[model samples]
Target: MTHPFPPLVEAYLADLDRALEGADPRERSETLAAVREHTREALALRGSDDDAVRHLLEELGPVDSIAAAAAAGTPAPTPASGPPLADTLLVVLSVVSLVLFIVPLFAVGTVVWAGTRLRAGAGDRSRQKTALVIGVVALVAFLAVLVSHYVATA
Candidate 1:
């Protein structure tokens, strides 16, 4: 029988499901349902499952981008903000950072600077904020070492 419908629909769904496999249960479920719906309707209308699948897959392109989009739907926080609270940890790191050759101080300074920028809400500049935080921490530690070393030697 001639495929009254396009095959791309099924292809699109298959790609979507494949991409969704590694996704969270909630996301997988949602995507599964949505993709199924789209495919079912398309195939039913065309009366050709295989053709519909192929056509859909061809038009939808790769599944990676779709997976990325799905993931982006709920963005993850930056590494700096994630975890055991860098704000407090940074102060400690600053001290540790200074113990060795003042390099750590520079790191501390960068971290602090980044944190400040973040607080100011740079909008799309969150990455900059993170870098600034690290930089502040490093810089502060470096300064601490410099001051200590100079005073100790002099």
Candidate 2:
């Protein structure tokens, strides 16, 4: 049996999906579903052929242009508004924790909080990951220094 979506149509959809990757999930799904439905309707009316699919995709315009239009229509908040609060806090705490080993418990708390936010996708993922890395490295170095100091004194 012929597939519901022709190979050309499938390729077009894949291109659209790639273009829409940065869009919100709901918007991306809605856009893709709408395009697929329109393609099916056109196929039904014009006959399921390569030429018809190509014509339809051409009329729809390039996928990158469509994505650009969608992104322009959407109101994405600007990073200039301020850095993400949780990520900023994570970085600060990581630095503080490194400088003041007297509060290892608090440092652990910061790591846990950053990890939670990272898992939840609540902050800048890269920033959170960097903060966690720095925190972990600082913690390890602090412990090593303490062990060496005690051994030397003994």
| Residue lDDT tens for model 2, 72-125 | 665322113244676888888888887876557646866787788776655467
**Per-residue lDDT for 117 in model 1?**
44
lDDT of 1 by residue, 55-120 (tens): 545544566766775666653221122222444444445444444425564465646654664564
Clashes of each: 48, 0
Task: Give me the runs in candidate 2 sitting further than 4 Å from their true place.
Answer: 1-82
Worst 10 residues of 2 by lDDT: 74-83
TM-scores across all candidates? 0.35, 0.46
Candidate 1, which segments miss by more than 4 Å at Cα? 1-15, 74-154
Q: lDDT for every model?
A: 0.53, 0.73
Residue 67 CA displacement from its true place in model 2, Å: 14
Best by lDDT: 2
Which ten residues in a row are the worst by lDDT in model 1? 75-84
